[model samples]
Target chain A: MSDTKPLVDVRDLKEYFPIHTGWGRTLPLKAVDGVSFTIKPGETLGLVGESGCGKTTVGRTLLHLYKPTGGEFYFDGELVTEKNMPSLRKQMQMVFQDPYSSLNPRMTVEDIIGEPLDVHHLYSGRAERREKILSLMETVGLNAEHATRYAHEFSGGQRQRIGIARALAVNPRFIVCDEPVSALDVSIQAQVVNMFEDLREKLGVAYLFIAHDLLIVHHISDRIAVMYLGRIVEIADANELNNNPIHPYSISLLSAVPIPDPRIARSKQRIIPEGEIPSPLHKPSGCAFRTRCPYATERCAAECPELTERSDGHLVACFNK
Target chain B: MSDTTPKKAPFSMQIDPALFEPATAEEKKQQEVMSESTTFLKDSMKKLMRNPLAVFSIVVLAFILIVIIVAPLVVPYGYSEILKYNGMKDKTAMNLAPFQYSANEQKYMAENGVTLFPHIFGTDELSRDYFIRVVYGTRVSLAVGFFASLIVLVIGVLYGSISGYCGGRVDLIMMRIVDVIYSLPDMLVIILLSVVLKELLDGSKGIIARLGTNMVSIFIVFGMLYWVGMARLVRGQILSVKENEYVLAAKSIGTSSPRIIRRHILPNCLSVIIITTALQIPSAIFTESFLSFIGLGVAAPMPSLGSLANAARQGMQSYPYKLMFPALMICLIVLALNLLGDGLRDALDPKLRK
Candidate 1:
């Protein structure tokens, strides 16, 4: 997998939002600061992080939905910029988190899915457009008879399917799934996750799946990168990270995943981190997790650590782990 | 007893071929439980139909519109023409009661073996047919109302959408301009424009000559001042609607900014726009009548509802019906429009849906 060129490569991305503070003052809120990673062709890179840790911001900035403060993004070894973003949009799409708000209420299912095709002028005629829309709906497991219905008439799971069909209209090669299943029921979540996996296999589409669910990420991702305070704290193979988490934050996060079996869950020890996650506006100096880390030291506070290879394919950002 | 016998052994493991067959087209159609497809406008119209008040208002408006169009064709007397008998001025026809005729008109009709059309609302102080004058007044008021609201709708939607979609500095500056416009006294603007345009449009032909300077200035004031309210409303709606996830979805698909505003944002703001435009009609009509009442409306010899009412005020003591005719017409039209606007608000608002 590593032998093939990376489909999406980022070399330090930054996004800062200027917030007004009255009296003609403006403060910069660093939403995503110097985050970097790469997704190989046909591989799923799961980005796991707590709320407000800039997981969604990274996905948005990569797609140019939000302009990057500073970064370089390469797709298929070609540099991406505002000039070529429109063409690149056809190759990259996004499935938003909320199903209800993502689909336009005023639009029918066919129009919603056919919108991307309309914008890009992908189809030849009305017949071809209808054919493309119905086939896309079928691919996302929606009934062809449901084409004319509004978004509000469908259930949550079905609405998400419509949203997915819309994202897949252009047959994108790389998709950013921003917590796609987080707003769904557990039963529906499994169905959606399985559909995503099946789509990846059939279409050979790479995905940057951002989710806070560790178990689901471990189940579907080839590589997982854990983020804390707008930075990637760890990156490793899914199983390697699950079995041997090196960063103090990653260890605590993995331990927090609920074990299904009561007998084994009682026997397992959960590592609870102390204090609260620091605010992105006023993040702690040096290491963001040092305030909550049990292995904090003078060196950890004096200098921030960069992600360095600790094992065969495991990377951790910590002085001692 | 024979039918009770087991068909093919209870709970047979063999699969039934019939069960695995694909659904036929008829069965597939039956599986779809949704009702017939409806567009946003059709859906809103359906809801509007369910409201009795809205339907009543629509009927009333339609009737008034038809009457205004047809009355002039049938009425024998022109709105501004003075009554004459045998090609000479008939002074006795002045201030005749509704359906009443002067002795001179009766004698002329009797002698000529021809019956003249009865004065439906009687002759006014100037001996013009009151019924025809009322009809013409309605026509002028309705036309002014429609054209003014249209002006407001076009200018307001454009300004508001641009101000809203472009946030921060652009929005701030544009909204400040709206605030300035909002603070200007509309009555004073109309009075000033009427005086100024009256001089500029003197002896001008075409639409200016037909509508008169006062009516033209009233429309100008409506275009300039009335739109600020609509602009503010549209701006507030767009501020909230542009934040929806669907708008972001549109941007991600590379839709142009104008397309986003037209297709995505504006449709969501339609309820507000429709309600405001409906309500705006009555106010525009009222403003025209008010200006005319104060002698700042359509010029003399051309009748408007307000001017008609103003002319009737002199005979209010002896001929109260003169004032009543135009006044009643204004009241009915404004009331119907107000009810329709309320009904539209109720019907179009999604939050009010059951």
Candidate 2:
């Protein structure tokens, strides 16, 4: 990872959706606020957060899927703005969640995968295009016969593979896998995760793999970034973060994962956080997680914590940490 | 032989021997692969084909259309020709019928056999055969309905699709115009416009004279007036479909707006448009009939269903046979068309099958 340059650099990115309160007034819903990350060539950065923590919004904003309300995004060390978005999009692609709904049902699988090729003009002729599509399908473990079928005919895993093929058709250097296997069955999820690993090995592509499954993220990611309420609570090397999660949110999330070993599981205590995630429309004053944090102090409410690196490479964002 | 011998490779490098061997316990418990051939369209078509009532209605409508198309050739006498039975005493056949030989007619002409030969549906007060007039009139009713409805469809699709696709201020302005037009009674507009057009084209001797100077012009006037509602329906469908994820995907991929509309949005709205077209055919036919009945339709000598019905209504009290035949045909035709339309509505309803 150190030998290659960073493909994407995101700093303090924020996206706030307006919540209309009738009579022409609207309040801002801070979906992604002050989120920072970077992806090196041939590296996968896992973004794990509970529902509504704005992890998906971060992926979208990095690719400029939604125009950012605030912050800077640099692609290949150059600042990515709306003006050069089309060209930047050619380099950066996204694989959306819900593989079933992401691909157009009306379009054939070939057309779906061929769309990017058509847009980019990568092929010399129709035969070359067909050969490329077949090779791509083979790379993703799909048959040549499946090219003419519609998206609805494929299984959830196959659909995600088709989506991966579409993203790869542009020969993009970077990809944001936004919960690619979240909608698939548990058995299918492993196949998709393995496929992602294979793609990284074969193409040397970088990915910001967004998923709530810590186990899967740990298996595939070099580093993990844990988020809570639009802010990343912790980020560190995968093994280091799993061993010593200093943030209260990260600690609770790690504690919830059931161990496969009965002896280890019997000794470990589960730290289940109480209550639900707060609405972004009316976020708490200081630390957004203060409402559900077990270690909340009077100071935690008065001041927001800044992320600081510990002795190892693990970064924690809490006053006590 | 020794030099050409193949060396045995390591188990890891060779293709997995487990696949050629027996399956593992773990592999055996995996979910079975379900076939993925069934699609939305096939499922819908299957459901539609199973519906006996819809099939029956379609058959009836086809039969009616066939009758309408061939009515002229099948009928023996011309519409305006007087069919006199007693050779020259045309008065005897003023209000005649079949299966009933006129005694006075029998005494005048013993050569000509029966009164029924000349008048299949019998004659009216003018002694013109009712059957021949009704048959010829089918042509006028059908032509007006078909041509006018087509005009409405084209106008409606264009207006609605544009307004729906480019939504916001443009949509607001277009819809406001639609609302204003919709507020007025459709029938009144048809009547007023036809009357004015008829008056304007009267006494003009050119191409207008060749085609019923007033009739062709009135049909055009009515067709233009009927497309507003259809446009509104199409616009409503387009508004909903445009926000779907596939549309967003197309936009993200840098597909042009027109291509997105033509390929994605328009195809999604086809079911609604087709079902509406079927239903509107009867409406167009009814509108033409009403216009002719009120004496604002086709001019004298050229028979239409409405004009025939009008003539029938005049002599209904005395020569009742004149009114009954045309009225019956109108009811049967409209009823059959409406049933066919209902069947099509079910066939095209996506939610009904899937």
Best by DockQ: 1
Give one digit per residue, the lDDT tens place, for model 1 in B1-354: 246543544455545554576889999998676666666667778888999988998999999999999999998789889998778888999999999988898998889999889999999877788899999999989989999999999999999999999988999999999999788887897788777877887878898777666667777778988889999999999999999999998999889999999988998898789878988988898888888877778777778888888888987999999999888888888788878888887776643444
Of the true interface contacts, the fraction found in model 1 is 0.63
lDDT of each: 0.89, 0.80
Give the Cα-based TM-score of candidate 1 against the true structure: 0.92
Candidate 2 regions exceeding 4 Å error are A62-65, A78-83, A118-131, A261-263, A297-303, A311-314, B1-66, B73-125, B168-170, B196-226, B300-303, B310-354
Query: DockQ for the candidate 1 complex?
Result: 0.53
Best by lDDT: 1
List, residue by residue over A188-257, the lDDT tens digit for candidate 1. Answer: 9999999999999999999999999999999899999999989999999999999999998999999899
User: How much does each candidate deviate at the interface, measured as C-alpha RMSD after superposition?
Assistant: 1.8, 3.9
Q: Per-residue lDDT for A1-321 in model 2, tens only?
A: 466777778889999988889998999999998998888888899999999999999987787667899999888889988788777667788888888668876677887888877776789999999999998899898888788777777788999999999888878889889999999999999999999999999998899999999999999999999999999989999998898888989999999887866668889999888898899888888899999998899998998887888856578889976
lDDT of 2 by residue, B194-286 (tens): 888888888889777877865677667756777888899999999998877567555555556787788778877877787777667667767
Q: Against the true structure, what is each candidate's TM-score?
A: 0.92, 0.81
